[model samples]
Target chain A: MSTPSKTLGDYVLGLADDALVSAQRMGWWISRAPQLEEDLALANIGLDQLGQARTLLSYAGQLEGDGRTEDDLAYLRDEREFRNVWLVERAQSDFGVTMARLLLFAAWQSELYAALASCPDPTLAGVAGKAVKEVAYHLDHAARWVVRLGDGTEESHQRMQAALDAEWPYLDELFRPVEGAVVDPASLHPLVLARIEPVVAEATLEVPQVAPARGGGRAGLHTEELGYLLAEMQHLHRSHPGATW
Target chain B: MRDWPLWEVFVRSRRGLSHVHVGSLHAPDAEMALRNARDVYTRRQEGVSLWVVPAAEIVASDPGERDAFFDPADDKVYRHPTFYNVPEGVEHL
Candidate 1:
């Protein structure tokens, strides 16, 4: 059970990166969602994640003591420097797939945030307190979609099941060890699964028994997807230098 | 064929207020209709409560019958309480 101790800043940085990357992917749904309402839904969800990322990233910079601002950490870092799990970095081109991933990620985050809401670090505790509410809504929205699609027409059911199967392997990465996290990531495993299992069952989708993917995003090992995501997300910030909106 | 049914959204901006009609959205069912209403109408802190009704379920006076439905009320000014003068200390009135 021996694990290298990670700095608190690193722990917070991982949470920040998860939100940042998810926000970027969610932003892709703008103008591309299945309906206008869905477009707005994705936009709102992305904004929530973006807000969480901003606060966490800014706090992480302060904790690091290296004078790295939120922008510096977010826009300046390469793919290899990010600490998010692989679950969020993958492309979510399919709506069903997006819902499946959001359901899993939000479920895990809800538990993590709830546990951290009372932690020793005030900033992390405060961030987790607010984030818990947001993730609760996020999880509900995703679960509703997952259930609808999973129990809907033939085509939708197939797609929803496929989406669940596709994303299940990535779920394990979320429970990987984090030395400085307020709660054990492993402890959130059963809670997350319990949250997800009912939704999957209701949706009539099988909990995929696939093997876990090779994941080490916490240590900067990421899939090719992260590189493309970083390129697009950082492009404007890096290009504009000191440009003001 | 249209994919979903239309729903009329009603939102209460705060407590102790009647739900006001906000707008409409298309959703597969009532649950999603409520969720869509939230995403579309309540994104900017617009509402504290939301209700979604199937658009087909709401009955409305036909536009062509507007005069028949409301013309009678126009001549009845007595229905309004504006003519009454308030007493000297009738603060709330």
Candidate 2:
């Protein structure tokens, strides 16, 4: 399929939405993870994602030239306006599911940001350079958890496998190409899959053989789950509009 | 699931410094314990290195022995280097 022609603002907003939505989902694990240590680890990961989102959103606002601040873009947009992939927007409560999603998403992000670090856009390249370092650690953290659960016990292995199966369908959406971006999403697919394959093998798990889900998140289409997610995410700011922290 | 074992964390902020105890956490194994300690204690770039020891393996002095174990050196002036006077221009001594 041919890539869509998008402005720099559109591209930046898509990247920002991915990190922002993923951070929201990750924040849900702060106090509910299996272990206390895991709670802190997930929270820290969420913080990293939040930081990346802030930078990307700020840059997007500048590119749009509409005087929309990052907060305005983040808190004022409706679900249909968001451009995050379905893999990040789906509601994930299972720990194994969370790890599986993170493993794939972070692997893709690691490759994406690494490539974006050298993009023609100076501001975008600068943001991606910093994000590349952070996402590398996120990828490592997710890879370790996937292995730990996938190889630990029979029950854990089963759950991990199931999680991977559930998340597999969303993988295709991440590789959908975008025109005018430094990184071609199509090119990143093999590199990211290669990174995940060894980790999956070490965990004694099979790469999922599911069909891909239909996705158009980059075109502002999203699953129903995003509406609820945005409602809760934007509730505080909407409740007290024009309020500053 | 059963809880993981407790681990005492120690961090060395820079080169030539000894690892000092910062805090503790729980993990399923040593590798995880080390990673957990890195996330929990070093998020602020507070350390250059980390050490995670199983809490059960740490042998700490008894709190009840505080006065008996530490009071003897309090008034031992004769054993102190301060009792000896330096002649002149001693930089580090």
Q: Residue-wise lDDT of candidate 2 within A1-245, one digit each (tens)?
A: 32232376788898999999999999999889988788989999999999999998988888778888999999999888898899999999999999999999999999999898888878878888999998998899899999999998999999999999999999999888864565778999999999999999999999999999998999889999999999999999999998878
Model 2 CA RMSD to the hidden true structure, in angstroms: 2.5
Per-residue lDDT value at B75 in model 1: 85
Which residue pairs show backbone clashes in model 2?
Answer: none
Candidate 1 lDDT for residue A134: 93
Quality of candidate 2 docking, DockQ: 0.77
TM-score of chain B of each: 0.90, 0.87
lDDT of each: 0.91, 0.90
Clashing pairs in 1: none
For A1-245, candidate 1 gives per-residue lDDT tens digits of 42322377888899999999999999999999988889999999999999999999998888788899999999999888899999999987999999999999999999999999998878888999999999998999999999988999999999999999999999999998886777899999999999999999998889999999989999999999889989998899898986568
Q: Model 2: per-residue lDDT, tens digit, B19-60? A: 999999988899989989988999999899999999999898
